[model samples]
Every structure is written in structure tokens, then in C-alpha cells.
Target: MPETPEIPDIPAQIPALREDPETEGTQDAAGTVSGEDGDRGTAEPEAEHGDAGFDLGEPGFDHSAPVVAESLVPESVRQVAARATLPFQAARADLSFGTAFWYNDLIETGGDHEVIRQYLVTATSRTLFEIGQWTLRGDLTDPEQPVDELVMGGFAKRWKVLEGLGVAVMPTVELHLHAERKGWRWDTQEITDGLAAQADDIAAIGAEPMPAYILGHEADDSGRSAHPDRTQRLLAGEVCRPAPDAPLTWSDPLPTGFDGAPVFAALPLPDEQLKLLCLGVALPGEGGPDAPATVVAFADLRPAIHALAPHRRRHWWQRG
Candidate 1:
């Protein structure tokens, strides 16, 4: 077997969850990223092994908590956030990074629920940084009754696996950089132009080789760890086009409950499929229609979720 790359060490002092401005009306105070296995539906406690100090078992791993300006947020996250031109106030202006996860309500009732497991690194700041994965374990047949659930934690434990899967973080950074420099507002024309300009670089990054550790086939291996090769290919930026017979659907500013804000955008892959991108923006105060927007979360949508409208899809949490 080939030598494996050393996994990075996670900080023992996990940051405390901070109050995010965007979490108004939601369960922000109770929302936290914990290391408990039973709460997260995991069979074992993976955080004890020291793989970045994250307990992969819990679903409510708060990715959006504000990090102190002096705290150690990932350099990659900071760099990407700094380069991107955000349209709203940042949650933490000092040193911050954004996070995105599927809303819990949508995940339980929405199609392509697995898409929520992925992590997204948007621009950094404290303006709007409370992120979590939504979870619901109760009966799905009753839509009228409120279901008790947790919505955070999948990415915290699997950060290493994501890195190994060849998800290029830098390309996203570069895209933000390019867009900011060009003064491109989050409009269709501007987004299309920016994507066209960066097509070459995106393709180059997508073609890179995936790491070997991600090549195993086992379900209990850890949150969808089975079929490593397939996962590798999918995460390696391989474009998945809609079936030729599949009807094409298009919507301007897809209704993602972002109040017509251009929070989500997509680029046409070389294969004619769309590469969906979602931006989690942090609003200044209890965000209303007039609240100024700031981007906190950034992520690429999984192929299945990317093809559908935001309203049609299920997310981990719903905005109040």
C-alpha cells in the first residue's frame, strides 16, 4: 500500500457557538455542534480517534458559529472569504468564514437528502455565520404535526474525507475573487459572464486526481463511505448531465426563500449539465425584506439537488 498523507490535527479547544445575526426566529441559542454519537445517529464515536476533534455522529454540528477574530478559523476559509465580494454585512468583520448545510425540515421531506452531508466554505465573517445540518427522525407521514429533531453535524467529522475526495476549495475562492474584481452583482448576466470567464480554470481543477484513502466500499464504514471510487469521481468535479430525455427546467433566481436575492447561481458544465452554487448570506439584524444582505455560506450543490428549484428541494432548516 502507498503511504497516506498525514491528516491535519484538530484544535482541542473547540470554539464556543456564538450568536449569529441571521439566526433570528430560529433555534440559534440551542443550536450547537456537539460530539455525541447517539444524537447524530452514528454507531460509534469517531471524534475520540482524533480525526480533527469533530464527532461525526451528531447531526447538529454548528458550522456557522462566530469565531473570535483571534481564534483559529481555517486559513483556507479565511482566504476564500476575504477574496469574495459580499453584498451584505459580514457576521464577524475581523476574521470569519461562512458555512452552509441543508435545512432539517427540507431534508426529511425533500428529495436528495444526502446532498446535505457536504460542506460549503463561503466568505468569512461574523455578520452571518451560524450554520447547521437539519435532522428529523420521527414520522414523515404527518406534515401538520411538528417533528422534534436536530439539524447539524455531518461535515465536522468528515472534513478529512471531503478533502480526500478532491473537492477543490481554491477554485471557489478564485471564482469569488474574479467576480469581486469585476464588480459583478449577483445577477444572471453577471453570473453567467463570470462563470464563462472561469470555465477553463474550473475544468482544470475538476480534472485533478482524487486521493487514495477515499477508495473503499462499505456503508457502515462511516456516513456513506461505501463506493469510494464513485464518491471520488463525483466529488472530483465530474460533471453529471441531465438525462437526454429529462425535461429541462429553468427559473430566474430560483425560489430558495432568499427573498429574490441572487443567493444561488450555476455554471453550465462542459457536458451541458449545470454546476449549482449556493451562497448563504447573512442579513444584518432580524432580516426582513429591507435588511442588507451579506454572504456567509458558499457551497456547490450535489447533482441531484442542483437540478431542482430550492422550493422544490428539502433543506435542513427553514428560515423564519
Candidate 2:
């Protein structure tokens, strides 16, 4: 593994608040008196003597005075009430895969964890192209923890049988995580088995394969490519198939054209065709478009894909 770069200290500019013992039991702006134990008490009613007695309808009484109502409420309670009455506004919810502890482990380890996640995704796609946006570890960990260093990427089980075959097969879900923490270990088999179990549960239900779409430019007569309708069709879930006989290829580094385009097809994998394939030949890893073909499959592939779908869907929805 390559050496991970050093992580810089995160700045903490906010000053810490210190409680002052001398101010204990002091009266606050809200007429309530706070005790040392943190409990609050209302100020004693003004000595009820003769005409000075408290009365709701007293002509000279200022009914809206802070001392009359606000002082009886604790500041914290008042703040909460104010917030509750504020207009509703939607905020993005954190949607991340894997357990919270898993993310916490990455953040705590603090080095190479992010890189490891990305590298895993890149390595797994040795045979297929990765699609969709990479998930952020920060989304899963405590908000106070810095997750700028951790990331995860995913690959679809289905690939273009041969670049433009129209028909595709999805046999598994592939996810990769990258973090730069030293002294951390990964139990590959355990992780793989857990993913397989989830996939099996999904497969048992026989759910239909989810649609996948692609967005790219079509070349003109002069070989210049443009994205006139790619964005709309891709968003509409239009299947993007390669031209017949066109070189079937995908790039690890996304194309410069569509910034957020879907890079993989979302064709569903049929249950009957989900069998594992044992290749009789080894394909060249660095070969060009004409490299010899070698079929590959793993029994756990389909289940893994199912396990990864929900997380990916969350991101997809957010993007939409």
C-alpha cells in the first residue's frame, strides 16, 4: 500500500463556555432564578399588600412585561419554544450504508482510511466500470468528526455483455471504501459473507431488477460529440446502449462531457441468469478494446448488489 499523507489538525475556533459559580442562583433575563443544581424557580410574587397585589386586569400593569411571563420560563425552554414555532424548512438527511461503528472506526483510525475506500472501488472495477457518486464517510459518522478523508464508491453487477449487446447481466453489487488509518484491519471474508446474506434476503423476494441509465454524447458526421438530449433522457431513465459494433468500453476517470451523468446501465439481472460463471481463460488486465474475452461470475455477486442498492438509491434521490 502507498504511504498515506499526514492528516492536518482540524481547527476548533469556538470558545468553550465556563460556568461561573458566583452567578449561581442569579436571576436571568427571563424572570426565572436559576439554582446551582440547574433547576429554575419563578421569582416570588411581589409582596401582596393592599393595592400592590397582582391582578391580571390591573390598568397600570404591563401584562407583556418579561418579568410577568418570560421571567418565569427558563431560557432554554423559551429557545426551544421559539424554534418549534419557526417555519418548516427541509434539510438533507444523512443516508449512509454500513453500521455507524464502521464509519466511526474509520474516523478514529485517522489515516489512509479514505484512500483505502477509493482504492477498493477502483480495484474491484478491474473488469467493470464504476458508476454513480462516491458515498461520503462523513455522512455516516458523528457530524463533529471530520470525514473529508473518507469515501466509498460502488459498481453495478451488470455490464454491457460486450459493449453494445443491449442485453446485460447483473450478478452482484460491489462497494469499496478508502480511508488512511494505520493499524486497522479488514476481514474480507466476514464482510463479503455479511453482504452475501443481505443479498440472499433480497433475492428471496424476487424483486425486479432496478433500471440503470447512461448519459453521454453522440458523435456527429465530423466525429464531434454533443449532449443535446442526453441529460433529459438519462434523468428520465432512458436506457443508453452503445451503437452496434461500436467499441464497448468505459473509463475509470469519468468523461469530461456530462458532469454528473450515470456511467453504468441499470438493467435488471434475471434470476434464472444469475448463475456463477467460471472462466476457462484469464483476460488481460491492461489490454485494449480488442482484448480476449473471459467470462467471470461469483455466487455472492447478486446478493452484494442487492445489499448496496438502498444506499445508492438514497444518493440518487438526493441528487434528483
Candidate 3:
């Protein structure tokens, strides 16, 4: 078998989930990315894993209680959330990268539910943070991922996936370089000139061949481990789209590993069927991805993401 050329390097350093020094005056704490699993149902605990000493989400939201994100997501749109959600993991050794969602609550309930979203949100956990950073190394524009410039360049390298997944955002840049683990909400509807595209775009910019699938993990279906060609990365889920804002579930139930996954939706581009992210599985203080999962709406964290939006565009941008 030929050697895999695009194998991602083992993450050299554990990201500073903690605050950095240069991140002064940047009060905007953007708790970027992570998540567990879902099957449009409840989430169960996997092997016990800590969040690397991180706190739950939101300010004055009562950290003492765990927020069940699943509650925020109405049953009407559980399928949509499941379909757009995907785990970011290495092809080998690695377990999971995390999950992300991109959709709204209209597809299933006929706009009956109260929450209406058109933004993207990722689980703000440590592993998910590393997974996101790995994507940075795969960026087509600047694979080098200048960590220093990454922070200064409006976090552009950090948002390529969200941008590719066809999510909308404000033209504001939320700086959470020092943000420990909290999110901000916004009511503004001014859509940023979107960089809407397919997961293919995300794969295209990778160091090697990658597939940004619409839903579920790649399956040979032949009940085999490796494909005959001996090439193709695979995720850990079935193939199918879920209802808008639904949970990403599997056989039996949704795994807790996806607690911080980002949720996406394709309602915005019905004809094209793009996987745009809307919210996350679980925020820091929100609780775990369990029976009563706590999902953070994209709009909830819009302020932080908006501040980081410039990174979705070009570097040398504003840090508003």
C-alpha cells in the first residue's frame, strides 16, 4: 500500500485553552470549537474524559447547573442538526475531532418553533480546539498557520471550515485569544458577504485528499475495514441528513464525545444543500451532550464569532 501523504502531524502543543499574555485589552472571549455525538436523540456518556480544566459557557448563566443543549434544540429540527453535524478526527489513532452544526428550526416544524438561526457554532472544548487547529495546517491559503499572525490576522486560518460550510456572520471580529471559555450573543441580522461553499471546498484546501461529506461517515458497506483502493478517510457515523437543527445521532444513541460538536444547516441554500453551521452541541457551562443535551445557538455566540469573522475573510482586518 502507498504511504498516506496527507497524514496530519500529531499536534505538537496543547492549545492554550487558558489565556495568553499578548491577548490583553481583547475582552471578547471567543470560546471557539468541540462537541459529542447524536442520533437525533439523546446523548450518552462515553469513556470519561475531562475538558482539560475548562469552564462552562455564558456569563451569569449559572455555571452550577449544566445546560442541556438538546433542550434548546426543539425535536422538530433534530434530524437537520444530525445531518449537518460531523466529527473531525484523524484517519488513524485519533478518536474524534468534535462535531459542528449548521441549520435552523424551520425545516421540520414548519417555522413553528421560536428559534430561527442562520449562523454557525462549534463546541468550545480542548480536543475540538486542537481539531480546528489541525485544519489550520491544512489551509490552502497559508498552511504554515503562523500562530502569531493567526491571532493577529483576525483568526482567518481558524474560520476556513465554517466559511466553507456556508455559514453567515457579521463583519465584526470577536477576539477570544484570551477568552477562557465563554460566548456572546447578538441580535444584528447584517449578513457578512458569505464565503458559502461545500465541504468539498474544505477538503480541496487540505494537505492531502479529504472529503467534506454532507452527512455521516464514509462506509464501505461491505463490512470491511479499508477500501479496496486503500485510500479514503472515514468518519464514525451513518450516511444521511437529519431534520433542521436536529441532533447528530447514531445506532442506539448520540455519544458524549460529540458534546462540543458544531451544528450546521442547509436551509439557507435549499437547492445546493450546503452544510452550514448554526449552533454547537454543548457549551462549557451548558452541560454535557447527554439525555438532556445543552446546545448553544449560533446567535448566542455571534458576538464572539462576529469579532472572529474577519478571519473568515482576509487577514490584517479589524478586531472589532
- Models 1 onward score TM values of 0.21, 0.19, 0.26
Give the per-residue lDDT of model 2 (tens digit) for 1-320. 32222211111111122232222234332212222321111111111212223232321121111121222323322221111110000011211111110100011111211111101111123223232222222322222233222211222332223231222222111111011111121222111111111222223322232222222221122323221111112211211113332222232222222221212221123532221111011121245434322111112332332232212112345464
Best by lDDT: 3
Off by over 4 Å in 1: 1-43, 47-263, 285-289, 299-320
Model 1: per-residue Cα lDDT over 86-172, one tens digit each: 111112223122222112111221221111211122222221223323222122112222322233332233221122112211111
Put the candidates in lDDT order, highest first.
Answer: 3, 1, 2
Off by over 4 Å in 3: 1-83, 90-94, 102-120, 126-257, 261-291, 310-320
**lDDT of candidate 2 at residue 304, scale 0 to 100:** 32
Candidate 3's TM-score reads 0.26
Question: C-alpha displacement of 247 in model 3, angstroms?
Answer: 18
lDDT of each: 0.22, 0.20, 0.26
* C-alpha positional error of residue 42 in candidate 1 after TM-score superposition, expressed in Å: 9.0
Ranking by TM-score: 3, 1, 2
- lDDT of residue 54 for candidate 3: 16
Error of 1 at 18 (Å): 31
- How many clashing pairs per prediction, in order? 34, 29, 69
lDDT per residue, candidate 3, 192-297, as tens digits? Answer: 1121222332222322211122222222324343211211122222212244344332222234334344432322233433333332234323233333333333
